[model samples]
Target: MRGLSVGLAGLAALGWAASALAQDVRPNVLVVLVDDAAFMDFGAYGGEARTPVIDALAARGALFVQHRTTPLCAPSRAMLLTGLDAHQAGVATIPEVIPPEHVGQPGYTLALEPGVMTMASRLQAVGYQTVMAGKWHLGSGPGDLPDAHGFERSFALDASGADNWEQKTYMPFYATAPWFEDGQPASLPDDFYSSEFLVDQLMDYLGETPGADRPFFAYLAFQAIHIPIQVDPAYTDRYVETYAEGWDVLRGQRRDRAAALGFIPEAAPLAPTPDRLRPWASLTADQRDLYTRSMAVNAGMLEAMDHHLGRLVDYLQAAGALENTVILVTSDNGPEPSHPVGEPGFRLWMALHDIEWRTETLGERGTTAFIGPEWAFAAASPFDLFKFYASDGGLRVPLIAAGPGIASGIRIDSPTSVADIAPTVMQLAGAEGAVADFTGRSLAEALSGGAPAVYGADDVIGFEVSGNAALIRGEWKLVRNLDPWGDGRWRLFNIALDPGETTDRSQSDPEMFTEMRAAYALWAADVGVLEMPDGYSVHRQISINALQRQLAQYGLLPGVFALVLLGGLGLGGYWLVRRMRRRRHP
Candidate 1:
């Protein structure tokens, strides 16, 4: 027994030495991505959600207060992995939102171009074991799966989002969940929840070939708090009365909290409530009840996701890999604004498919729910609009990075975009040379010792989605928010001083606005941004895209059958008329 114990101790020491050596070479990268979470949804960012795991991570890492992602998911995900502008990455906008005229345009291909290398590919080139789980909306089909892009093992959902608890597509744009495992069609385990299932799959991948001496890059994307915001009943119960006061009050509360936390200037002006949103006081009791429950479900989803994230962190700690791993937590975009469950097309489709949105099942297995524009507006807090617009609310999101070399308990106020993530991760993995030439700057300097700025005063950064556009040069930002959100007017603001974008300095600073506009035009031309058709509306474009898909899938078959049936009826009628005429003549 004594001899066996001595042998075990020697083996343990050898294992420790191996792990230490691996840490010295390259830190393991753990990217925790959440879908459609608002800027202040997590407790770490000052919202009411209980996210102890994420908060703890913020405490140990740099919290980027002004970080921005594209206003939607796919484009942001593309930028995050490729370290390039969304247009340069070939996903200028989501497929469902792309107009037919713009479908095959240079930057509107709706998928990452084949030659574009991903962060995973860059890291894997340098001996890292790259693995990914959860959402992979960059592309679809066998050739587009994560394995093809450099992940050695991947369990990916190639759609925007799907049902959290069931293996089914949540939106009509997808016919199925489109889940895949290492480039092959895969099935979900019987017991599944997006957050838990993603973490478990990543852990499984990490455990395979355990003795191999290689660092890892794990991208764990969660479909939490997206549409169909379901969570365990226990989690939902905790926030039952949390949002009883409604979005109006919640918006003010969150705005104040953000100012207090220095996320916004102390005197930052609140953006006016969008004209489309109905006043909370005008809602019926049932409407208020349903909306309130939906908000609770949203919060519950975040808390549940955080809890599962903690489980993964705990596992890493148990394996003695936590200290050597760099973990980043962020959202793909801002709060979702579309209320699909209430759309005319959605209701018709649900009726045809025999699905219903029962209040009792609001956040349960078979029902769908969302926070609507009102709550989404509040969720974005002091920012101007929700998802699908270029307002700070839609683009600015939380970015937390913690691990071996990152500075602790600090807030990095420098402007950072999702495009910077790939280069930053490559730097941390010590695979800088492996990465392709990209536009984003590395955040290494800012992460360790504070850098005054990541971009030079003359360097221009531009963003565009659907039709909304914004360009930032030094302290000035020139923006255009299309229809419903704005009057389709060009505006300007010194974002450095007025982050909420309440005051437009266009009239007051014509010279700066003119310069910024020219810069945006130049950037657009360089990136091959296509012109939006006149009267292009994102909401209308989505409906048209859905119609196109339906026609492509089912319209042709039914239309052909109808034509054949009508032809037969016409022939019979002609024969009857001829026979009747002959009888009359005889």
Candidate 2:
């Protein structure tokens, strides 16, 4: 008996030694997150953007056709980093659209709560050098920046978005573009462009620890294609005529291309264009030119982002780190539909800030532009609607994974969520023990071709933010979107057969709808999802919040003016009353 025990102990020690050695050679991780890119926005995904770098990655990596994320930015970001639901990570929704009743609530805190462990923190615990660059909208309160959330060296913008060409607020919601490096306020250079600066900062961080034996977990969150989209004219000039055909024709082209690529069924019906948008032919020539120029700029911004990303890839190759690095590229949500130019009082604000919206310089510095809803709908071809809704078009986006241990030239059609990203990264980095702490399952097997799918047919997943809700169970999806885009009712669709969500199966498949609806109710209760107040609209709430923030920032002068105007009126009224009384007495 004593001899047998001694042999078992010896085997256990050998296993531990083997694990330690394997951990020492774990692959470096590079997670690239783009803001508000649609499912078909990248060239590899059948869009007009000249994204050679990202396309090359897709060519040699796995591209996910059914990946879903929250419809909003901050919530999706929270899920991507923590491998948990948006609520579990303490960012139920973005501050810009958060309702007043839900503020400061348990899940709606808009910041990472205590005890939440991020991917960077977990990787750093196991000897990985973690760094980050670009947008960090997770939080802005005390200890809410990237440095406090496991990033070692970070140049993070702690807002929804800011000017791409300078350190200024893009919208009236912010007083300034709050940027920080290593937890201290950082300033930008005179020639700063967002995409270039973000990549430059990441390279500097990587170069600081040259030839280090330890691996790295670098997160590059680009603000490309977000609001105030700006890029060099050199990139924009190539696409000046690409969108002249307008959004309706572009929508059909994308849908056909998506079918050819096997992203959807050949017979899948395209979602009807919303009644709110005018037909392309009805628009005046000037309007068409402006819209066309805006889309060209959108493509240019994406291409510029790709060009800069290639620089980082080149740097990694030169340093011999590319061979053993795992690169995952994805977007936070679908394309943005908001057009600030059309909003009331927006022109005045633009003029006040020296922002121009001319066609000739659409994507240059000092210009603010967006693709708006029509183009956003076109960009999200073969699917319904765009961002800020729970429809597939808003939640479904592209995900590409490449590098060591990941199979090349693979396309994964299985349904996956952004929450699954952190666990997969941890698993690849040899931090498997920490994977159990997250709600998201690892996609390591799927990426390695060990399994065709991650979740079984019985598995259920639920997502909600600012009243936009969706639940998935196998081939069925239950979605409820409120206000502007949706009628505030639950609709069921078989996503496997209809990725476009053109047909509602609630009445046709009653049993499945009932079962899924009940399952969603249970999941929502378990997750502590708060019901939105009656008559709530995210768009309305955003305007309210923006106005409140603007008032708080620059209200004193306006307040004084209003007070002075009221005082003069009061004095005039009193004098008139006194004169009327004297006349009556006389």
Candidate 3:
């Protein structure tokens, strides 16, 4: 027994030595994930929000103008981390928007399945310390938290979103914030703000192994700019009058700015505004004020997040780790479009929770604020639509990478997918063996000024979530978005010429369109893409899911109320029958 113990100690010491050697040669990686930020929502990308830190990051690194992700958050996250399609990563759709018919069917399980490896896991296997802080809407099942997925330390929120100031659910989809630290339930601090707390937690984790030569992979997923877009009044004050021109004018302004910034073609026609949006001049004065305040709040929330990010960067620089760290900043998807205040039963739910929706306190604590679809369209700018669809407006977002071995002040316009992120990180970390196992190709060469682009013109990539689908082949894109915003028919566009998707080339280029459709069909089958049910609408599905979750959370009280109402109705009918019979006899 003594001999065995000695052998174990010797092995442990050798393992430590290997890890130390690996750390000495490799650089640290920091991934900053913003929630529901649009393609042009950063100051570097010509957005109204003042994001100086991110803008600086862009100035010093490669900015990808044609990068796209899955149209929803969880799926984009899964793909971003795994280098796989959303289905392959085991999160085809989020719980809030998934239909009942699709539950528990293979990739629709909504959790990372067995044998799937995240970037954290891959990096950890190579002796890198992995830590994560912020929203982790991945899964809550056993072995599904960040700890099980190779994060050495994690403070994760396992819900779509929650109040920024308190430990409460943002919508009826969840009962609580559902925060966890290292897989154990946790609570927020007394003076909690989402962005500040998330950064603080990450800094704490990074400090745990201070001066230790072990390379670290830090994932900071901010909940900023998502629904319930709350920020300090100080930040909100900066944008109060910025969006007063309203969405229509804002949309045109953004499109023009995008062209000026070289993000799109100079003559790219603007996509038509969504029909559901009312003309800004036609709205009541009160309505305009409310909406303007809400947009201001959204911008403020993003700026606040950027401010906190600057803090983390400063911390790393002060710790002498910034010089060797590779930083990647991006959003999960396009801007959020849902307005909980207008959703059925949401007002009552807010009332029960003492939440306010007044314009006077739009971005303050205890108030729920959102930009809704009109602002979402403007935020997306030169693109066709926003989140929950396959439109570029939903999928195309900002991606900036700066660090060792990356080119400075370069913009790569070659189409790139979120799945490419994991492989790129792996290559940068010198973990090349695992890159082959992933479906995504590495962009390390492009970032390092070696290659012009990552994907060749002939390469095909596909995306699908909740029935919305798109196929990208070189410069041409074939997309089919579900109803309410789209006709469910496939349309072809030369995205290189019209990034705004202003013209449909399906009729003009029949042969290419048919070929791309066939390619998409093959890709979908290869990726285990499930067919959505007839007339499947993401909005309707969300409503259905919310009702189901609400019933599950507070079923007993509602059930009792329903029974009492039925009982009272039965009694009233009996009384009426007796009175009528008595009158007839008399």
Q: Write the per-residue lDDT of candidate 1 for residues 298-318, one digit (tens) a residue.
A: 999999899889877876776
Badly placed stretches (over 4 Å) of model 1 are 1-24, 352-354, 555-586
lDDT of 2 at 161: 95
Clashing pairs in 1: none
- The positional error of residue 502 in candidate 2, measured at the CA in angstroms, is 1.5
State the weakest 10-residue window (summed lDDT) of model 2. Answer: 560-569
Model 2 per-residue lDDT tens digits across residues 1-586? 3223323333333332233225557888999999999999999999899999999999999999989999989999999999999898899998888888999999999999998889999988888888999999988889999999898899999999999989998886788899999889999887788988888788777655332556889999999989988898888888879999999999999999999999999999999998877678988898899888889989999999998899788767755668788999999999999877665456667887899988888888899989988999999898999898899889999999999879999999888999999999999888998545777889999999889999899998788988889999899999998987888889999988888888899999999889988999999988778999998866557666765666577687764442332221255633443344334320
For model 1, what is the error of residue 310's alpha carbon versus the real structure, in angstroms, after optimal superposition? 0.7
Q: Cα lDDT for residue 364, model 3?
A: 92
Distance from true position, residue 436, model 2, in Å? 4.5
Pairs that clash in candidate 2? none
TM-score of each: 0.90, 0.91, 0.91
- Residue-level error in angstroms, candidate 2, position 190: 0.5
Total residue pair clashes for candidate 3: 0
lDDT per residue as tens, model 3, 388-449: 89999999999999999899999998989999999999999999885448878899999988
RMSD per model, one decimal:
9.4, 11.1, 9.1
